[model samples]
Target: MTDLPLHELAIERHIAAPVSHVYKIWMERLPEWWAPKPWTTEVVEMDARPGGRSAMNMVSPDGEVSPVEGVFLEIAPEQRIVFTDAFRAGWIPHPPFMTGIFAFAPDGEGTAYRAAARHWDEATMQSHSEMGFEAGWGAVADQFKALCEETWVAR
Candidate 1:
């Protein structure tokens, strides 16, 4: 393994719900509010287990569809999830992007959800950061929280 840049990015948001509830929404109904605008998740398959397959089709504003497929590296139900964009369904190496880890922790009557991405190089990290990752992701998180709250209350 070569020496990568090792970029770490994290965002924490308080969702108006319990950890289990929030986690369920994330895993089951992620496409509801995953992307603030044009993007959306079409979960081709989600096994929620180590070595399980996961794929999502993301549509851009201009109607360009980018299919991101990967595998679950780790999964701690209602606590944490670790996934990588290493291989797609065809068992081919997909675009070399960073790994993602999403964690949910109990907060007073709510849940503290954290989304983090680990990049392999400084350039990659900087490029993503410069592309408004913080703002875009923040918006998505807000949307996610709202969706979760709504779903929980409706249940």
Candidate 2:
């Protein structure tokens, strides 16, 4: 059998907005389009720095809530961001999960955005895939694009 990568799902899209704008929304406007609406999201704490915390709650329509808490391993303004749920703030170890890297680069007048998820093993990768990684992350990306373009057009 072939070897499975330790990394999991990754998605990319070309968003018709500036790199800075795309980066800004990921942090500042996250809650607006974080979850596929009907299910909304809320930010609890986001210091947005290396070793800083990133916490949010995603609430379903029926009031079920799921919290995502993690730390920013790296933050390159308007360029890239790396965070992981494997550890909480202050470098405290938690249950090992997924690490994510979000990046934006100028593509023509817009930006090329990428969200890549890394897992510790094949099992974790498979679990995230089965959890609708594509559909869910894709939806949020679309929502983010619309929100950014709409706001840009309005300005």
Candidate 3:
């Protein structure tokens, strides 16, 4: 199990799918389950490698778009992914809210998926928590689990 730092928030789920399938689905279909219901995600570009750029826009129901730009710090296929908004591609500095860490491991015939958000300070973590982090991340997890399980089972 990954240690939970003081400035971090995380959620975990056990999905009825293999780790490889879960990881592949997440990388290949990120825009589908990245956002909660009533809000959709659009992947502008994603280079799934260390130091690669990861960009996306989340569109609200009312058409408000929130763009996110980050760089991948690490990508261990079927194991883990780490990214941060602290910098853009080519190491350009940017205002960062948090660093994202996602891990996937095999649990029998399923996968143990963990998603974590690491903030720069406790205040930032608190702000994220107060912004419905639990509900939002939980909903996204459910969406992802359902998609991975359904897709894997159907194949």
Candidate 1 segments exceeding 4 Å error: 1-6, 89-92
Best candidate per TM-score, number? 3
lDDT score of residue 81 within candidate 3: 99
- The C-alpha lDDT values of all candidates are 0.84, 0.90, 0.96
Could you give candidate 1's per-residue lDDT for residues 1-155 as a string of tens digits? Answer: 97655697778899989999999889888787777676766677887888888887877877888776788889999999999887664456877778899999999999999999888788888888998889988888888989889988898
* 1 against 2, candidate with superior TM-score: 2
Question: Cα lDDT for residue 42, model 3?
Answer: 96
Best by lDDT: 3
Candidate 3 residue lDDT tens string, 5-47: 6598999999999999999999999999999988999999899
At residue 148, candidate 3 shows an lDDT of 98
Question: lDDT (0-100) at residue 33 of candidate 2?
Answer: 94
Measured against the true structure, the TM-scores of the candidates, in listed sequence, are 0.88, 0.94, 0.95
